[model samples]
Target: MSVWPAYAEIRFADYGEDFDPSVERTEMERGVPKQRLLNTDVLQTIEASVQFRSAQAVEDFERWYFIDVKRIGWFSMEHPRTGEPINARFRNGRIGRLQPLNTLFRFAKRDLVIEYVRAPQ
Candidate 1:
């Protein structure tokens, strides 16, 4: 498989209500600070804790990125503890850092936002 960009952003449509201050900080800090989250070109998978609307959106995202979800498998999982579906990025290139399920603030809508932290490097 051709290596793609290491980092990408995924937004879960239904995070609803509960918001994490830390995530908000990271999301907002994408390109502002010297060390920005957007500067995350070394990671392989960036998982967004959230809920998605339909499987079609997931498939679409995979197609857009040229990634095979079936091969990629469950990029993210439905949180067992929380019951919300989790969307994530995986394979290829970066650090292994994940937010705790509890730490994940919910988004409103229905789709999950995920980012690939690293690409085949």
Candidate 2:
């Protein structure tokens, strides 16, 4: 058996990208007021939403996320806007849910917060 858990393949069409780039700042006493030091790399946080029309779809995704993906801790994900692949994991401890108002439809929506993981040098 493979060591990796079997997770459902889910693609996100659109997502919000947050890229934060910063530099280390230090306060100087005598000459300079502030000193800007080391440059920090970009930190990425992606926010996405997925809608499941049926109960089966919801169950499948939930199992894949909470059981398989969550168990693995980290996985590769493709950025929706740039299409660049990055190592990412769930940002929040809990998943947001939105249930359809109509009982007949039984649709479910989930909002996901994914944070990119930096590689070690």
Candidate 3:
């Protein structure tokens, strides 16, 4: 599997953290609603933005994104919360375009909604 580019600085923003549960709720006749899990193997999603500082870092990220993940469409990176390695794909199978952090173009950032492909070890 393709690994996240080390050059990409994961300056995560203060957004929602933790995996969202995939559940199916059932309406009961006389009792509380029952919830059933839809996924047992795949875990929660990791959504965050990564920052790229420096010209070379941006170039490296472009290559990795277009070449490595273009076809396979998935990559492995450290879980933002757990710090353990996990397999994940672009959130909704797509990544948003990068934006310059400032006018100078010395920094860049992109939003990523990464869905876990499997349970983390």
Candidate 4:
């Protein structure tokens, strides 16, 4: 699996835990309502902002993202909070537009949202 670039420094911008539970609702003989919840785990998604300090780094990221991942493949990156590698895919299969901090392209930044593919074992 492809790993995140070492040159790119990821900063956690937002973290969200998503929960969608299966619910069953039934009416009792006495006209009472009952609800049952299914067992499930909360999935996680991370919105991270990364900065590329040099033009070469930005170019490398573009190549990695577009060529290596093809924009829809799974990759591994260290979690900012847990500091463990996590399998993830691009959320909506896209990254936000990269913004250059200067005309010389010495620095750039972009935001990314990735969803966890599985829980850590």
- Local accuracy by lDDT, each model: 0.36, 0.58, 0.73, 0.78
Candidate 4: residue pairs that collide:
none
| TM-score to true structure, per model | 0.21, 0.63, 0.79, 0.75
- Model 4 residue runs over 4 Å out of place are 12-41, 118-121
Q: Rank the candidates by lDDT, best first.
A: 4, 3, 2, 1
- Sort the predicted structures by TM-score, highest score first: 3, 4, 2, 1
lDDT of 2 at 95: 50
Give per-residue CA lDDT, model 4, range 10-45, as digits (tens).
Answer: 755444445344457898889679998654443477
Q: 2-119, model 2: which lDDT tens digit per residue?
A: 1212232233664576755555656776676664634445556777765666667667766766766764367665555666676777776555665553575366666767677443
- Ten contiguous residues minimizing lDDT sum, candidate 2: 1-10
Q: Candidate 2 has which clashing residue pairs, if any? A: none
Question: In angstroms, how far off is 85's CA in candidate 2?
Answer: 2.3
Candidate 1 C-alpha lDDT tens digits along 1-121: 3332222233443233222222123334456633224342443223344332444433444463445454343354444335555454444422233333322222222133334333222
